[model samples]
Target: MSDKKLLLLSSSREGQTDYLEHALPLIDGFLDKSIKNVLFIPYAGFAMGYDKYEDKVNQPFQTIGKKVTSIHRFDDPVKAVEEADAIAIGGGNTFHLLKELYDNELIDAIRKRVDQGMPYMGWSAGSNVAGLTICTTNDMPIVEPRSFNALALVNFQINPHYTDYQPPNHNGETRAERIFEYVRANPHRYVVGTREGTALQLKDNKLTLVGNKPGLVFRDGEKTRPIQCNTDISWLL
Candidate 1:
């Protein structure tokens, strides 16, 4: 990827609880201070808590003097993503996010935009798209196929929401476990299991980790060996 071309802020959870704080700066970094146009798409919210999550999110950008316009639905979503000096897709369930992207032909459009040099930011499912495959996401196939094909923005795959926590009320396998099984079966790709507050930042062929703690990179069924940012992501790339 070109320098500063794609800033991925993949979080393990939803809402503004410090997640936005970690994500919003990437937007500000991309703000073309001279230009008044910046497009923000909020469709991932649709799959999560619905419009209930919108205002709280749209508000912070306003306070920062960032011009943010929002649209929901499969209707012309790509146009909004295509023209932004920067674009951010909020967090939500990957299944619904994929449906919206596929329905609107956004999968192809996003790949095109990034190629044309648009800096795109995605939290949660949005971040997963930057990888070559959606196989690493924590989301289940609640619907049909859902196109395992992805944006292919980076050669590596992302497993956001990569928590190793197991709450008493928690049901099913932990996100980390799911990814472990995935890697066990297919031993090629390097998967980053990002815990909450942790993000994989990619810019201009440079990839770095910022936030709460260091992330884990899994390969051949073993825990990661935490490579440094200056190393071209040798584990994954």
Candidate 2:
């Protein structure tokens, strides 16, 4: 129950960046000796498309030195998460991910598995599930989420790819700023910005960084600041 490892990749892991290419390889590293079976939980991309987010989520295991058996579930969901050595969730829409997790009764299964030391990896919307509340997610709720309580596996809310780059047609503040604003008002929460090509690695109760970039932690109304990464995580060490 204590050897679990989690690699929560920010949204852009599917993006075409040079260092982002290391995404899958880093995932493979988690599966090297500890992981034997893999469960591909494509709940986030539920209604979107079976494209990059979902395929990329599973493709890493199919090609690597490790031969992982994948299970994609829209049904018989409970059995899927319960039978795996590891669980990988892909990115797309955060609401959709929450819906599927609730509808399929996979939330309890996932939380239980993760608590039991199953290696769990998620990207983007998938990664959003790392925090206690799904409110920090930047994705517009195309559909109402089934639940607002995230897995609460970590102590902070994760705003993956926290960019100040605001695109036009957006209503108010940019997604990043909106998240910051929301958390600012709600001072009880802690949020971390997992930038592109970077990941928050939680293993054996240790949280560390992987890929090329480091994550930024934001609190209060202050701007996000980068912390030194790539070292033993004092948090769980």
Candidate 3:
């Protein structure tokens, strides 16, 4: 895992901020200066055409002196991944994203690259694929993938855009309850519930939570706990 570098964000925007604005600084810090071009995976943005998605992302990336070329633009996506200096995945529907990845046979190609020291960044559904499996994702199964398994860049599961708030007079499971259910079913695994603005950073064998709010962790037979920002959580890795 020493060669792995991952920045998994809970969401693209945080409370009225511009798209990716809150994450720009963290992205800059995570990426190496040598990385000028980033390969983007826009499969999750199925509602918005890939061309539009790429344009939306490039706007922010250009500000940091980096450029993103969407994988959809390439004839051979696996080859694109192999040749990419870095990779960034955008958020939308996790199921759609996974299905597209499997259809294009890019899961293994991307995993191999990231395992060999390529930088990876993702947000929301994008972040969901970085976990052990997509079972913990908040997204609806609008489409089915060949498998629930994901990148496994980290050892645990991720629940992005996590919130415990129960709206007035609404009868439904809270976010914590859903995560609790997942832990009960998968007793051995850990689930990290990242708030809207938070992110999990893994580099140099160290894992840290970034942002002002604390993240939540849930596991079977263990008390749920808060993960403070800017603290070491490599143990979870």
Candidate 4:
């Protein structure tokens, strides 16, 4: 059984809630008192500056009684990962975050630390990197990474901020259609369309959907299945 612990959130906010407000209780429960200093990665902030992003994330974490130290503040990020008790990656542009992760050479460092059983938490683009690759990301390719490869912490892909709503009078591919295209192209892969307010938590080789809403799982040659809350999805692990 895998020893890794992860909390992958679809978004920082649910509905009109304040930033990270909805996720505060979840984050508190995920890390617990064992995690004191959380290594924060804010590279996902493209439009917003990294310092601001760090502060934005720090607020909720402090409320939950956890201290946050962003990787950007450190002179050697790899070393920071080595000493971190836990890690939390904040949300933003997926393409930009992946590019920064590659540029900073954190991909392997993070993978190694998390593999060693350090708790890892992420939201939005943050959660996307926990998957096999960034190919299933919902963000536009504003910046290209060295590759679409990610932490590979999980075997499947995750489509964060998944929604079924389409604006009126718009002639665009629906979210499901786009994911179907990905499945058609990669027949061997699985993609989980995780909606807002929902998260996927992995602990002791068990994967549970956290939230009131159900998430959709897509696979090749099979109808998309709805994953209900508290369901064990270790089959995908």
Candidate 5:
């Protein structure tokens, strides 16, 4: 497996907190001290314009003393990835994000750079594409991507913004139940149900779950497992 550095977050905010407030510390620590310039991928931002999305992320990075350049600003998007010391993807619609990645032919470029050890960070829909496929995303398939395949920076599939909550009188499948379907269909694969406020960190080839709440793990023919904070989950790698 390639040595990839990834911080996959469930959500940018925790509860009703400010945008990216809860994750700022994590973001600061994930980025390399030498990484002054970060390449921001704003493709997942469908409803909101790219400029607004970039500006939203810009605030937090400025607080961390880093400069963020959105890929959209670059005429040669692939070149931007090659030169970036770090990469960050904001959360939005998974399908739209994948479509843009494929449209711009950035999948290979990003995978190569991250495999070479450039630190990568993503939140919500952004984190969804870090997995093998976008099949487990919680987003509606408003747009069809060339394929469901994604970055594959990690071995397991991630269901970000995972929750056990079910509204009263709702007959739809629970989040866990939806993930179970993926587990059954892809028996060999493992799915991590990362709740809001939680993140899965991969550093030095070791994967760990961070945040207060435990993340649920789904494997074929196995009882669902709960991964606590600071727990090593490299087996999923």
Candidate 6:
């Protein structure tokens, strides 16, 4: 746990902000200056090809004076992870991403690398996979992975892109109700509902919620609580 460095974002864009524009500052600050290149995992990007995904991410990374290389470009993806200075996983479909990771056998490789103090950052579905399991993700199960278990980068579950808003005449289950159902079945676990534009940063044995909006914390038999921005949530660790 002491060796882990993570930046888990709720979403890639905030309302009308440009792609990766809202997160550039946090991304730049979270990554060490010594990291010249970031290994990118674009498995979640099902609509666009990996090459296009790489190009999309590079657009903003170049602004920060860093380069991004997608793992799909490498002959040996596992070796790529082992040798990367840092890694970033982009958002798309969670199930597809997890399946590809399992199929390529990069799960253990990535977990091992991050455990060795390599910086890891992700957004949306990418952030969903950073938790103990992908059960809390909002994406529908379009594909199945080897298992729902994920990287376990963080001990608890994460509900990224969280929103409590229920539109008029919309009778669908609210996000809170959905999360309540999850905690009811998995009582001991904690789920952090990271709102749009928010991120969770873990460094120096402390976890800080980043953003202007407040996040939510959920557990069985307990009232949901709001986690203020810049608050230390290392207790979840």
- TM-score: which is higher, 1 or 3? 3
What digit string (tens of lDDT, one per residue) describes model 3 on residues 1-237? 367999999999999999999999999999998899999999999999999999999999999999999999999999999999999999999999999999999999999999999999999999999999999998889999999999899999999999988999999888888888999999999999999988999888889999999998899999999999999999998
Candidate 1 local Cα displacement, residue 233, angstroms: 3.1
lDDT of each: 0.67, 0.71, 0.95, 0.91, 0.91, 0.95
For candidate 6, the 10 contiguous residues with the lowest summed lDDT are 1-10
In angstroms, how far off is 83's CA in candidate 6? 0.3
What is the per-residue lDDT of model 4 for residues 1-237, given as tens digits with 9 covering 90 to 100? 558999999999999999989888888888868778899999888689988888888887888788898898999999999999999988889999999999999999999988988999999999999999998898889988999999999999999999999989999989999999999999999999899998999987789999889999999899999999998988888
**Tens digits of per-residue lDDT for model 1, 1-237:** 354466666572434565376556655664556645446556566644545555556676665576556656325677767666776666766666667678777888777777777777777878887788778877766764467777788787888776668889968887767777878888977787776666666665666775656677877756666644334553354
Residues 1-237, candidate 5: write the lDDT tens digits: 567889999999999999999998998888878788888999999689988888988998899898888899999999998888989999999999999999999999999999999999999989999999998999999999999999999988999999989999999999988988999999999999998998999988889998889998899999998998897888888
What number of clashing residue pairs does each candidate have, in the order they appear? 4, 0, 0, 0, 0, 0
Off by over 4 Å in 6: none
Q: Which lDDT tens digits does candidate 6 get at residues 1-237?
A: 367999999999999999999999999999988898999999999789999999999999999999999999999999999999999999999999999999999989999999999999999999999999999999989998999999999999999999979999999999999999999999999999998899999988789999899999999999999999997899998
Off by over 4 Å in 5: none
Q: Which of candidates 1 and 2 is the stronger one according to TM-score? A: 2
Error of 2 at 157 (Å): 0.4
**Pairs of residues clashing in candidate 6:** none
TM-score for predicted model 3 compared with the true structure? 0.98
Report the Cα RMSD per candidate.
Answer: 3.3, 3.2, 0.8, 0.9, 1.0, 0.8
Question: What's the residue-level lDDT of 172 in candidate 2?
Answer: 73
- TM-score of each model, paired residue for residue: 0.81, 0.84, 0.98, 0.98, 0.97, 0.98
